[model samples]
Target: MADLDHSSDDTSVDSREESSQDSKLEFSEDEETLVALMYNLIGERWSLIAGRIPGRTAEEIEKYWTSRYSTVSE
Candidate 1:
């Protein structure tokens, strides 16, 4: 455990900011379903998807969808 350095090594940020960032990264069930529906409709238009779901960015949405759906070859 002494070798691990998960916390800030040199910089510090407010807890509220950390929590808000954490919240943005998390995807609730409803959000997931919405992402799926929107994906079916728009087909990888990440900016549009992010527009439908506030607080989430296209980059994160793309990352989440790929992570959730990716397997073996894809």
Candidate 2:
């Protein structure tokens, strides 16, 4: 019988799952509206827009916008 090593593959899959879970943040309707307003006013300057949103970073805001609103708006 031959044994195959799958520990490395399992670790990589777990890390990817963790990252995906971390990225799945939820925004309230008010927050979404505010983000949309800021996006419309300032364009894609995520850093600048992030300042207006409390508890959210530029990267998070940018990711959310790109994933949720970019296609809809365009």
Candidate 3:
């Protein structure tokens, strides 16, 4: 019987994380307002809300929202 390799490649994951870490997104005042409004209206559906923003991704938005709002709410 031949052995199948089940190990997962983590290089892509590491590269993605590294890229995201390196690329810091600066949200404008308008973008901040939009994100807040959309978050309030949609409630944590970051991907859907991200579509409304031009240069932002769901992960970035989610991270931003969490860092900015999560602690204040608690």
Candidate 4:
């Protein structure tokens, strides 16, 4: 009775939902500065920082920091 093999339709729908949530990040100069400041203050506590920045998810902030800055020193 369990005939639910991985359906392409389900995959496509899930992908669409994820893509919608992960929209392009349009961070202003102030936001970048704030992120840097917040990182320096809290140190990797992304969720707390994201709370201060409107419309930004913790994942986005982490991704931006990783892409822009080197974490080799830490």
Best-fitting candidate, scored by lDDT? 4
Tens digits of per-residue lDDT for model 3, 1-74: 12222223466677887887656356789989999999889999999989999878899899888877776653
Which residue pairs clash within candidate 4?
Answer: none
**Which segments of model 4 are wrong by more than 4 Å?**
1-25, 71-74
Q: How well does candidate 4 match the true structure in TM-score terms?
A: 0.63
Better of 1 and 4 by lDDT: 4
Better of 2 and 4 by lDDT: 4
TM-score, every prediction: 0.65, 0.63, 0.64, 0.63
TM-score preference between candidates 1 and 4, better one? 1
Question: Model 1: per-residue lDDT, tens digit, 8-66?
Answer: 54234567667765665579999999999999998999999999987789988997888
Q: Which residue runs does candidate 3 get wrong by more than 4 Å?
A: 1-25, 72-74
Q: What's the number of clashes in each of the models?
A: 0, 0, 0, 0
In candidate 4, where is summed lDDT lowest over 10 consecutive residues?
1-10
The deviation in Å at residue 4 for candidate 3 is 32
**RMSD values, in order shown:** 6.2, 4.7, 5.2, 4.3
